[model samples]
Target: MKFSACLAALFGAVFVFLPAAAAPVDAGHARVELISERDAALPGETVYAALKMDLDDGWHVYWLNAGDAGLPPQVIAQPSSDIKAGAIGDIVWPLPHLLPVVEGEIMDYGYNHQVVFPFPITIPEDAMGPVTLDVVADYLICEDTCVPEQARVKLKLETDQAEANIREGELIGKWIAKSHVPFPGEARVLKKDLNWSLSLRLDGGFGKVRSIRFFPFGHDILHPAAQPVELGRHGATVSLSAADMTDVSKPLDGVVVIEQEDGARTGYEISAVEGPPLPDTSGLGPVGGVGIQVAAWKLILLAILGGLILNLMPCVLPVLSMKAFGMVSAVSSGHAGEVRRHGIWYTAGVLVSFGVLAAIIVALRAATGPITLGFQLQNAPVVAILALVMFAVGLWLMGMFELGTSLQNLGSGLADRDGDAGAFFTGVLAAVVGSPCVGPFLGAALGAVMGHSAPVVFTFFLAMGFGLALPFLVLSFVPNLYKLLPRPGKWMDTLKQFFAFPMFLTAAWLAKVLGDLAGSGAVAWTAAGAVAIAFAAWLWQREARLPRILAAVTLALTLFGVTERAMAPAPAIGASSAYAAKYEAEPWSASQVQSLIAEGRPIFIDFTASWCATCQVNKATTLKSKAVHDFFAANDVAFLVADFTRKDPAIAAELARHQRAGVPMYLWYPAGSDEPQVLPEILNQGLVTSLPVNP
Candidate 1:
C-alpha cells in the first residue's frame, strides 16, 4: 500500500549528479526560477519542469498545502500551442518544517532554504515551432513577518540544440524523493467540539517515529493548536484543533510527516473524509488510563541515571573494575594528558557501542514488530560468543599469555597497542558485558523511547553510555582520589589477578544461560571451548613456531564447534519464558491477559529474559519469595511471565505498548482495572507484597 503522492513519476535509483542553474528572479528573501530537466524537447517528448525557490537564511515560503496561514506558491504555466501541459498539478512539494509566527502565535508549514515544486509537461504529436512557455510565479516569503513575491520566467520547449540537462534532472529527482508519499490506507476525520481527530493507518517499519505531524492544505480547518499523536498497533490518531465548529467540519487534506528516531522522515499526503476515526489499537487517550505518555526530557534523564547505575551491575563490574584501575594507573604515573585522552577515547567507545545498538533497533523494528534493550543477548549464538569472549578475558587476566599491560586485558586484547586503544576497548568490553543487565531507572526511560524517534532513542542511549563511562572519565581527570591508595606494586598485580575470577564466574553464568537456551550439550561444548581457549593461549606463548600454528588451528576449531554444536532449544522446557522452575509462572500472551481480566483476576506480569542479570536477581529474591507468592495465591492474581530470552513479535509489541525496549518490566493490574501499573525496574520484597488485593 505504499503509494506515491505525486502525479508525476518520481521513483528512481539514487545517483550523484551536478546541478544546472538558470537566470533567476531575485524576490527579496526568495530567489525564484522556472526550469526543466531538458534544455529542449521533441514534438512527441514529455519533459519535467519545476519552480525552484532558494530562500535566504532564516527566511521561508509556503508549501502547496500551507497550513494555518500563508499561501502556496502558484505557477501560472502558459505553454505555446505546440506544447501540451495540464494546469500545474498538485505541486510536488518537499516535506515542510513547522514555523511559528510569533506575532500572531500561528503555526505555518513551509520550506526554509530551498524547495522544488515539480510538474510534468507533454509536447503534442503535431508539428510546431519552438515551444515557448511563459511562466508567472506568486508566493509569500516570511521571516518575522511576511512579503508577497512574484517571478516571471520564460523557457523554450523545443530548439535545435535541445538536450537533457543532467543537473536539472537530478535536482528534480532528489526533490521528488522528499515529497509526500500517499497515505496508503484509509484516512478519516472525526470531530468533537472544536477538536478534530485525523486517523491514519501508519504501517510499521517507519523506524521510531520522532514526530507524526499533519499539515492541512487548507486554511481554518487546522489551527495553530498543538497536534499530538497517539501511536497504536497498526496506525495512529492525531489530535487536531480547528478555529471553530465550522472549520472542524471541513475535510482535512495535507501531508503527514513521520519522522523516525534517526533523522529520516516520510511525508504522507492524506485526504480524510468526515467519518468515524480508525480503531485506536493503542487504547491510549483519556479512556486508557493516562497512556504511555511521558515527557521526553524525563525519559532522557532516566536513561542517564540508568546508565550510571549499570556500572555497578554484576555483569559489568569485573570489566569496569579493571578499567577503573587502568585509569588510576595512568593518573598515578603522572601522565595527566594520557589520563584525559584515555577517558575521552573510552567514552567514544561506549557511545559507538550504543550507536550499534541503535542500528540493531532499526533492523529489529523492520524485521520483527517491536524491540527492547538487551536484544543482542537474545540470540543463542550471541550468548555462546559472549561466553567464549568472557572465558578468553579470564585467561588473559590469569596471565596465560602476555600481550601488554594487565590493564590491556580489560579491553579484550585491543589495548596493548601503546595508544589509548586499550582504554577505548575496555569501555567497549564493559558495554557489551553490561548489555545483559538492566539497572535502576533504565526500564521506563528505555521504554519511553521504544516507539519514539531514532534521534531521541540515540540521545537517551548516548546519555546512558556517558553515565556508565562518567565515573572512570572523572577519575582520569581527578588524581587526588587515587593518591590515597598505595603506589602500584605486587598488590596491584594481585588485585588484577583477583578480578580474573569474576570474569570466570561471569563466563560460568553465561554458560548456564546458554544451557537454558540450548541444552546440556551446549554447556558442555562451551566448557570444552573454554578449555581449548586457555590451552591455545598457553601454546601461543611458546617459542616454537609449530606450537603457534597448532594453537591457531585449535582456536579455530573450538569456535566452530562451540557455535555449531548447540541444539535447537527444547520447546517443552519453555526456553522463551522465565522463572518457571522457581515459581509457577504461566507463559504470558495478550489474549490470556485479556481473558484473565475478564474473569476479574488481578494480574502481575514479569517481563524478563534469561540473560538479563537484573531480571535474574529479582527472580531469585523479590519475585520468588514465599511471602510474595502467598500474597498472589490468596488474591487469585495471575502470574504471567513474558520472557524475552529470545525475540518474540507479540512480546515485542507488548513491550512497546508499555514503552519498554527490553525486559525486567513488572506490571501490576488491579482486579477491576485494565491498565497495568508499571513497577520500578528494580523489584523489592515488600514492594511486591504491599499491593492491595482488592484495590
Candidate 2:
C-alpha cells in the first residue's frame, strides 16, 4: 500500500530537459519569466520549460486548481511549424501557504515568493529550422487588492548552441524537490452538512508532522475559507464545504501541504474515496474520559521538567553527584573561568548526545517501523557492554586506576586537557545512565516525539538535556553556591569512593538485565569481562610501554569476546525464564488483548522492560501491592505484561500506537471502553487501586 502511494505521487513527475529564457517582465506587483531547462533540444526530443514568477511581498497568485474565487495562471504555447508543443502536463505546483481573504468567507491557496510551473514541448524529426516559441501568460496577483496580470515572452532555440545554465538548472531542481505529492496511505471523504470531511490514515513513518493543510483542486466543491484541518498522530481530518449538492460521490482530489516539526514543507496529491467516514482506529485522536492531547509548547516544557527531575533519579544520581562535586571543586579553587567553560562544554556534550540519539531513533523509525525507547537496552550485547562500562566507571571512582594526572585532580575543576575531556564525557554519561528511568515529565514529552516530526523530536530532546544541565550551569556561574561545599580534603576522596558502590550496584542490575536477555551465560561473560578489564587496567598502570600495549590489546579482545559471547542465543519464550519467574502477570499478545476486550473485561497492560529501572521499581511496589491486585481481581481486569526486554515488532507497534517510545507504560482500559487511560510514569497503590471500573 505504501509503495503504491509513492508511485501514485511519482506518476507523471518525470523530469525533461529544454533550453531558453527571457528577461523577467514586471506585471502588476510580480515579475514573470519563461525559463527553459536546457540550452537546446534536438529534433524528436521533448523539451522541459518552466514559467517562473517572483511575487511582491504580501501578494499571491493562484494554483492550477484555484479554489473558490481565484483564477489559475494560464500558459499558451504556440510553436512555429518546425516545433510542435505537446499537451502540457499538470503544472508542478509548489506547496502553497494558507491565505485568508475575507473574514470567515474565503481562503486562497497560492504562492507569495518564487514559484515555478513546469511543462513539456516536443519537436518533430522533420523540423527544418531553429525552433521559435511564442508564449502568452495570464495570472491574477492579489494582496489587500487584486490585480490582473499578463505577459508575452518569446524564445529562440538554436540546435547547434545548446544552452547550459548551471545556476538556473540548480534552482529548478530545488523547486522540483520541494514540490509534494499525495500521501502514501489511505484517505476518505464523507458527506457532511453542506460539506465533505476528509479523513486520512498516513503510513507509520513521516516523522512527526508538525501541521497539515489541504488545497481543493476543484471549484464549487470545497469551501476554501471554512475548511479546517484537525491533526492526529497517524491521521488528519479536514471539513470541505461544498458549493452545491451535485453528485458528491466522485473521488476528491487535491494536494496536501504538510509542515514537519523541523520546519520542512512538503506536498502530496491525494485522491480520496467519497463514502461514509471510517471509524477512528488510531488512538491518537480524542476519546471521551481517556487521554488528553497536549499542546506542542506544553510538551516542550514538560520535556524540560522531565530532564530537570532526571538528575534525582536513582539511575543517574551517582554520576550526577560526581559531576556536581567536580563543579564545586572548580568553584572553590577560585577558577571562575574554568567553571563556566566546563559547564559550556558539558552542555554541548549533553545536547550533542541528545541530538544524535534523536536522529538515530527518528531515522530508524522512518526506515523501519516503530521502535521502543532506549532501544539499545533491548539488545543483549548492548546490555552486556553497558554493564562492563558501569563496572569500569566504578573501578575508576574507587581509585582502582587513575585516568590521567590532570583528571585525578577533580578538585581543581578539570581546567586542563584531561579534565575538560572528563567533564564532557560526564555529561554524556548522565544522559546514558538517566535513560532507563523515565521521569514523570519525560514520558509524555518523549511519547509526543514518536508521533511528531524529526525536528520537533530533536527540539524536545535538546530541551530535556538543557534542563538536566541547567542546575550545574547555574552553579558554575554562581560563586555563592561554592560556599555550601566543604573544602577539598580527605572527605572528598572518601565521598568519591563511596559513590562507587552505587555504580557497582547499577552494573549488577545491568548484568541481570543481560542475563534476562541472552540467558545466564551472558551474565557469566559480563562478569568475566569485568575481571579482564580490572586486570588490564592494573597492568597498564604498573608496567612500562610494552606491557601497556599488551594491556590495551587484552582489554580490546576481552570487550569484543564478551560482547560476542553474550550475544549467543537464548531460550524460547515459553521456556523457564528469569522474567517469567519475576512477574506474575500473563504475557501480553495482540490476540489476547483483543479477546479480553471482546469479552467485556477491563484490561491493565504493563508495557515494561527488564533493563528499565523505573519499570522494576513500579512492578515491585504499585503493581504487586495487595490493594491493587485485589482491585483488579474484583473488577475482573485482565493483567497483561508487554515485556520489551528484547526487540518485538508487534510490541514496538503497540508502543507506537500509544505514542510511546519506551516503557514502564501503564494502560487501563475500563470495560466497554475503546480507549485506554494512560497512567503517569511514577505510580502508587492508590493510583492503580482507584481506577474506575465499568461493570
Residues 50-129 of candidate 2 have per-residue lDDT tens digits of: 78888888888987765556788887766542444353444677677777675334667777777987766665566565
Q: List residue ranges in candidate 1 displaced over 4 A.
A: 1-296, 405-419, 567-578
Query: What digit string (tens of lDDT, one per residue) describes model 1 on residues 620-694?
Result: 888888999889988998998887776554565566556666778889988967678888888888999987656
- Model 1 residue 80 CA deviation (Å) reads 66
Please provide TM-scores, in order, for all candidate models, with all chains considered together.
0.58, 0.58
Where in model 2 is the C-alpha error above 4 Å? 1-295, 406-415, 574-581
What RMSD does each model have against the real structure? 20.3, 19.9
| Local error of candidate 2 at residue 292 (angstroms) | 13
Against the hidden true structure, what lDDT does model 1 obtain? 0.72
TM-score, candidate 2, is: 0.58
Report the error of model 1 at residue 676, Å: 1.6
Supply candidate 2's per-residue lDDT for 63.
Answer: 77
